[model samples]
Target: MRKPRRPDVTTLELVGGAEALELELHSYDERWASSYLEHRRRISDTPMAGKIEIQHIGSTSVPGLAAKPIIDIVVTVDDITAEEDYLDALVDAGYELRVREPRHRLVRTPARDVHVHLFEHDDPAVDDYILLRDHLRSDAEDRSLYENTKRRLLSKRWDDMNDYADAKTDVIAAIKARARAARGR
Candidate 1:
């Protein structure tokens, strides 16, 4: 239960812009699932995997949705704020810690393609991500709406990846609302 350590970033620029420039949405690739499986295997082989809960999320996880071809994985750990617990192990596994913010920690492969989001176990954000992913998996209408929104916004060059992600917030919130309401019924 040690506090998370700030990433060793002297060697790299803060990643938002450097990372965003690398984003280019592509038509859904069937290989994304296989890629996820491969990543899952690699991650599972790591010492931290036993304590980590992994899942494929974001548009890349949704079949038929256009995405950046980078897989988004949500990993729940005992205490996301405690990076010392797993950061070194993850780094050893070839993942570099990228963003470290309250409530979230991110790591990515050397190529900066796959994003691994770490949340504390039982964090609501984990539920939100999984809920949206599950909802999209089952609801074609919302899925289409989300995909259309992304496709429309993808052409713009964003200075920061967060800006691009922000553009989708409204749609994501709306869809999540609907999903919540449906479950309440």
Candidate 2:
């Protein structure tokens, strides 16, 4: 791991107006699942995989949510702070470091539609994401509720994508808590 360069102007410019954009709803289709898995597999085969573990996550991975048509991949590494040399691999792989959200994780993308997350395993929030995704998969009621909320949100005008994501925090937190309690945590 080497020291990371300070984000260049392009990276800074890309992190613009974090608003919740309107969500586009699509029927629960096998294509989304298929595409997501295929993309995940392709990403995993990349050289980046030697340094990162990739997982398909987000609403699209949930199987039945009305979501934006982007496949989200969460990639975990040993230390994000140390991956300076590997950042170029992502760029060469056609990804843009859109958000340098050092607080949670440094999220990037090979494209705008799909987000490819980069995180250090030391970050607990990555675990949260994995757990929440697992919980949604296990609980049918939770899945239904998520789909309903997604439909309602998609029907509205959002300031940007962040607003829509922020709206789901309450329900997501509730479901996470329920899952933990049920597991006797």
Candidate 3:
């Protein structure tokens, strides 16, 4: 089980400064799946459609899990460094490039309700995302634990949404560890 590295904030080229936004978690909604499908269709219509792998990830992907009402999509391409191959297409599809870091790039809708994460095809982070989502979907205890962790963190005032995400790293790691162990990894 390879751990995903969190890039230093200084290394990230952010198009928009981390804006102060109220963080609120919404109950699991079936519409999240529909939202992901709609976005998937939009992405599949792009030129790189057949060449990339797209998946719905994060809390929103798990049924019964509360999430921040944002659809998280992961796209794996042959080379993340070659943004020219896919970035422009995504931007043209109505997404704004938000975060660009080594081996990763993030684009989201202007409304901030949908985030698309780009990575290299072989990146372990992709597996981590799927594993965590699968685990949460199948394990009731871990699902509750994760939800509780998010709710607890929600009480704190976060200057940036990334800070709120960073706060959940520990709990997420723990859950992933258990997930890996269960798989005999």
On TM-score, the candidate that comes out on top is 3
For candidate 1, lDDT tens digit of each residue in 1-185?
24434432233235453444646778889999998999888877788733788899988898878788789998888776567777788889999888876777789998868988888777789899988998998999998999888878877888777788989999999999999998893
Quote the positional error of residue 122 for candidate 3 in Å.
0.3
Clash pairs detected, candidate 3: none
Candidate 1 displacement at residue 63 in angstroms: 1.0
Clash number by candidate, in order: 1, 10, 0
Worst 10 residues of 3 by lDDT: 1-10
Each prediction's whole-model lDDT (CA) = 0.81, 0.68, 0.90
Model 1, residue 9: displacement in angstroms? 16
Error of 2 at 181 (Å): 1.6
Candidate 1 residue spans exceeding 4 A from truth: 1-22
What is the lDDT for 170 in model 1?
96
> Which candidate gets the maximum lDDT versus the true structure?
3
> Scored by Cα lDDT, where does model 1 land?
0.81
lDDT of 1 at 113: 80
- Could you arrange the candidates by lDDT from highest to lowest? 3, 1, 2
What does candidate 2's lDDT look like per residue over 22-81, in tens digits? 458776566767877776776666665345677778777776655678777887775565
